[model samples]
Target: MEAVPLEHILLLGAVLFSLGILAVISKRHAVVVLMGIELIFNAANLNLVAFSRYDPSLLQGQMFSLFVIVVAAAEAAVALAIVLRVYQYFKTANLNEIVSPENK
Candidate 1:
């Protein structure tokens, strides 16, 4: 059995994080932004798991990653609820329109 290098894992994580940042920046819809956030979370998880694998003596990275996943799940739930309400009230999921003063 062979192990993957930490640099490779970190590079993958960096790519995922960059894509997530791009999506969050360029997308106007709330749902797309949420998906971007999930990407970012997954990237973080990947890094944590990679680090934990290298340091088997302590599983703190994995434990923190688990907590991060839990928090991301809860954040998604609450954010989606807010997006839903905003859609119902404003009739659009575009973040720009939702926050626009003209919408009110």
Candidate 2:
């Protein structure tokens, strides 16, 4: 069986990263932005895992990717908690309208 090319994995990661960026830029909802951030995190994880597959000696990349996934999960939980609080206070999830007093 022929192995998958590393370049293909890298290209996929790049596409995911670009889509994440576009989502963050074009979406007005906070949760959507959070999802975009998660996409970027997963893209990076995919890159790491791909590299680990290509390099037998560098098993650390796979471990690091696991840690990154854990951290991203924690971050997503905290971010969602914060978003809920914001929604409770503002009654809307639109990012452009979320102007705190500190921003004034």
TM-score versus the correct structure, for each prediction: 0.91, 0.92
lDDT of each: 0.93, 0.93
Candidate 2, which ten residues in sequence have the lowest lDDT sum? 51-60
Candidate 2 lDDT, tens digit per residue, 58-78?
Answer: 798899999999999999999
- Model 1 spans with C-alpha error above 4 angstroms: 99-104
Which structure among the candidates has the greatest TM-score?
A: 2
Tens digit per residue, CA lDDT, model 1, 26-87? 99999999999999999999999998997889999999999999999999999999999999
Off by over 4 Å in 2: 101-104
Output the lDDT of residue 69, model 2.
94
Show pairs that collide, candidate 1.
Answer: none
